[model samples]
Target: MQDAKSTRITFLLFPGITQLDFTAPAQALSRMPGAELAGAAASLDPIATDSGFSILPTHDFASCPPADILCIPGGHGVADALGDDATIDFITQQAAGAQWVTSVCTGAFLLGRAGLLDGKRATTHWGYTHLLPLVGAEPTKARVVEDGKIVTCGGVTSGLDFALTLVARLKGDTVAQAIQLAIEYNPAPPFTSGHPDRAPAEVTLGLRTHVYDAAAARMAAALGATT
Candidate 1:
């Protein structure tokens, strides 16, 4: 049976969001009874993802319902949004009253840019965790870090785990477990390259790209930081 009170989950949409970060969590939360899902953007238009897909925004900034939970998903567009006032303001406003404010990957950077993660223990994509201090957040290395009302998960696939955690928080362990079982949420990777610590040095170095450095520069420029 659905709960008497529905939980409103709003995901912030941008031009180049990583679709999995939003979709994974959206799917998990939607499975919870009485959970309402929405995708909000600056305008009511289709938004593109880094993975060559597009998703339509269901609500615009001014028209979005107050969020019970506000989620931000990360992608290459994150650097651009770090300097976007409309995006930052929307997050600030919605998060103020949200029961839980959460993010996946560098989505935490958006929360940090909105000044919500200041002094909060948070996590982001492994490639960008070092940048948390750039926005006043205490960087954490956990896959999912929950500090009060804020819950941040690391990297792309972590959104799945993060959403399950959110369900457990809002509902109960039993409900969360039931949902987990329904989805068959089990991860068994064939290799050990999930994290920097586990991956071989050569494997990690080979995969490293300049994209993060460029993004970091953009973030610094947007925040008026000298570095």
Candidate 2:
């Protein structure tokens, strides 16, 4: 058996993945010096991100090695990806043996939908946080919540915070703090907050409506898939 320390890390990608949720954490994971990082998905082709970035999946699920750490990034495709048997089955199989399962933004929806978040505290992008419980999470508002083997983040941008938290946990606080210091990342926004509380009600409502529309559209398309 591979020692927990020796296990490799792989990030899972699905169509319509949120760019920051996938990239920021992948970057942070790579900061661990010798640790290996891979983007694994249903296909090794380029996957589309919600913010319009394109990421090439380096490993296809069929041939990818098991993960010690796994990341799931959410996007507009959650409804469809959640219903995808191949996508969800692969996640289920990989997550079963992985040391930790993590997600950013609405990606938690896919993880929650996969039965991974049942009775586990998890979160998604604030735009659709309520949906986490609709799927299965206890719905956390924290930028990052490490709930045993399950970790989740609140938004696309928070993915950076999630990665920072994960690194501190996985590699130790000094390493994590150094990274934070190196990045000059002591943040204090004039807005005084980071969630709906920080933003105006109108802004929050508009964002929520948009996310819901996307999720609903995907759900309509996923009606009969086996995921």
- Over 1-227, each residue of candidate 1 has an lDDT whose tens digit, in order, gives 36888889999999989999999999889999899999999998889898887899999999999999999999878878877889999999999999999999989988988888889999998888878898789998899999999999999999999998988877888889989888888888999899989999877666665466666566567566422
Q: Which portions of model 2 miss their true places by more than 4 Å? A: 1-7, 188-193, 209-227
Please report how far candidate 2 places residue 75 from its true position, in Å: 0.8
lDDT of 2 at 220: 39
**Model 2 Cα lDDT, one tens digit per residue, 1-227:** 11245547788888877787788777766766456888888887888877767889889999988888888887777766877789888888889999889888877877776788888887776666655656556877677888898989887778888878877777778888877777777877788545778778887778768666566545534533433
| lDDT of model number 2 | 0.76
For candidate 1, the TM-score is 0.94
List candidate 1 segments past 4 Å from native: 225-227
Q: Each prediction's TM-score against the native?
A: 0.94, 0.86
Q: Residue 204 lDDT in model 2?
A: 70
